[model samples]
Target chain A: MMKQKNVNKRHLRNDILLIIVLLLVAATGAAYLFLFRGFGDVVKVTVDGELYGVYSLSQDRTEDISTGEDGRQLNRLVIREGKAFIQTATCPDGICAAHRAIFRNGESIVCLPHGVVVTVTTAQTQGEPDVVV
Target chain B: MRNKSKTTAFMGLFTALALILAYVEVLLPPLFASLPGIKMGLPNIILVFLLYRRSACSAIVVSLLRIALVTMLFGNVMALLYSLAGGILSLVVMILLRRWNVLSTVGVSVAGGVAHNVGQILMAMLLLETAELGFYLVVLTVAGTLAGVFVGLCGSALIRKIPANFLFLDK
Candidate 1:
């Protein structure tokens, strides 16, 4: 009986732990989708050591950077007024499309496969920095 | 020898079943609009079945082969990496859970599904080179819960029909 009870207790404890982990995972996602969506507003764009385009988040506009026919890959970054996003890339993943726009200090857009990055370096808010480095 | 052939055939069938299920799930609508990698993980049913009826080595082989074959046919090699990570992690978690005997088939299946999601997210972080991607974990976990329950139920039903002799065979 004692062994059975112990097993039951262990099972219960594991169930509780699973629930806690699930909640933690859910909470982290909610915090990002809700709280961190609008934390920046500056726009800067650079490509292959050259400035591509800069815009204002307050203003709505899109900038395009094109690679030359020489097949030389271009490095690019875009900071929109106060929000920063990936301005250009030649890498395959295109994961930058998923990055949150950077509006505060420490926010950056990096293409690891392409070795390109766009960083936001000003803190408009006094809380934790927006992007994960 | 005949028994060994039968087991091999069964394993192949299950692997094929998993591949078909994966393709079907991919064609379905997204579970959440913001989450790109959230999957129902229906293919995990085959893993659960192999766990209960076959050796761990067989389960691993089926998992790896299914991932490799499916990715080669319809997806990128990068996707194969994510599936490999998810499959290995989930298999380990299930193996550990199997030891307690306290977990029902459903419970073990749920654990595997959750582990799979966690593993995929970790791989995504490394591939993307951004920890900010961790934000997707929440969505993946919720999706995992639903998928876990579904796969768990399917696993339990599958185990009910498997013969005891087939489960115990060692050839």
Candidate 2:
């Protein structure tokens, strides 16, 4: 009986620790979602080494990028002068629509089904195409 | 050896539960326009419960079978791959942590959630053929943390209410 009690105590302690850790992780995630909004500010898109589209986040305009053999699928990207966002896509997951306008460095847009990427680069950094799809 | 029939029955039941959870989550509305891959991961509750009561091998088998069967029912092969990768990674992490005895079912579930996000991101990187997608890892991981906790809590509750002995009796 004593041994069983000790085991139960250990399990309880472990459970508490687990809850604490999970709370920490969830809190950190919430913080990131709230705090990390405007960290970058440039919009550039390249396809197969060719400059397909570029938008300034500061301006309010939308550009349509159609990629595929005959343009059967449409990938619409919105650029508000300095900010870039994916407005829509024909992909099944519609993942591209979830990306917000990125005007800062290290921010990007990826359409896996369509094989396209749009990235923001820092002004000070050399403009090498970050990704080609 | 005599318990093999019982084990099979338990596995079938868990598999059904997982499939139901997966279907339910699919019905939930998307959280945001900017978070397409995000999900509540309700099925993970069942996975976590299985992990604690059954052997690691059983947990892995269940995870794999659940993904395959659920995907087939939904007709989404891509989603299946993503789930499989994430599930396997989480299972490995939980199994390893189980050795230290520091992690409860919830902790292991959270770890598994993080692993799943990592696995999905890796697959995205590969499929898209671009390292630029790596930036999304941070967001996915952060989301994973929340999802993991929710699933972990659910798993803890489930384990308590339905004793493992009853569930694994057939096994």
Candidate 3:
């Protein structure tokens, strides 16, 4: 690796401008994220577009959620300390595993490859769509 | 004033540096690794350095070669796909921003850093067939921006020291 010598003068202005832009973007983005944060009480796990299981986030347990036709174990949904998260997933992306814990209503963790959707919902809105129909 | 052999040697050295960085990142325990959307983006420093000091084509080649070599040495198929998607997207953005010449390496690296995360998230969304990943981008954007700053500092410091050789830089 070549050594870095002195700093450039013109690049400084642009660098500062870039930093400003990035800080602004990050600030607005943080606001947007906080603005729409959820508050669900129930944790719902769905597999392959169908309802697989529903558990209360208030309780603590380890659930092995099997997905797809073969029913091979793909995700491990863990509920503890009043939050829900995927302890593990055998899927390709592991997006579900990467997700932070969810406890608020409307928060969800999705495993794309296995078609698993773990969502947090209020007791009132739970199954409202099917029941309304 | 530039020798072909020296240029070749620089290219090889950059490629090796990138490979080492990538490998080290993978073996760095699980702090950022377990966090999903969060990454240090240490390897990006070299890419940004090359983009500013060297030619974009060589930078691209080095970036792709680094990804391929790293994936082959220590990653799986999914990792390969993710690296490819992220590396290409990041390089493209950095090249464009650098060409604009309005932004500094910091800005270019920031764009590149954020683009890498965005690309990976998009690929994840496609594989998962869900938009909930959108929620994750908020965190990712923040993480990416911070990582970009770190990479920018390193790249800026390094690029500033390198002797100016206009061989491949002529564009």
Fnat (0 to 1) per candidate: 0.22, 0.38, 0.36
Q: Largest lDDT belongs to which candidate?
A: 3
Candidate 2: regions farther than 4 A off: A1-41, A46-61, A123-133, B1-5, B31-34, B75-77, B167-171
Name the better of 2 and 3 by TM-score.
2
Candidate 1 stretches greater than 4 Å from native: A1-17, A28-38, A42-56, A65-133, B1-4, B161-171
* Model 2, C-alpha of B67: deviation from truth (Å): 1.5
lDDT (Cα, tens digit) per residue for candidate 1, span A61-81:
454444455646554444455
Q: Rate the local accuracy (lDDT) of all candidates.
A: 0.66, 0.72, 0.76
If chain B of candidate 1 is superposed on the true chain B, what is its TM-score?
0.86
What is the docking quality class of candidate 1?
acceptable
**Per-residue lDDT tens digits of candidate 3, residues B47-151?**
898887767988898998898888788777767777888889999999998887766787788888889988987876666555555556766777778788888
**Candidate 2, CAPRI quality class derived from DockQ:** acceptable
Candidate No. with top DockQ: 2
User: Lowest summed-lDDT stretch of 10 residues in model 2 chain B?
Assistant: B162-171
- The DockQ scores of all candidates, in the order shown, are 0.24, 0.34, 0.33
- What is the DockQ ranking, best to worst? 2, 3, 1
Deviation in angstroms for B10 in model 1?
2.2
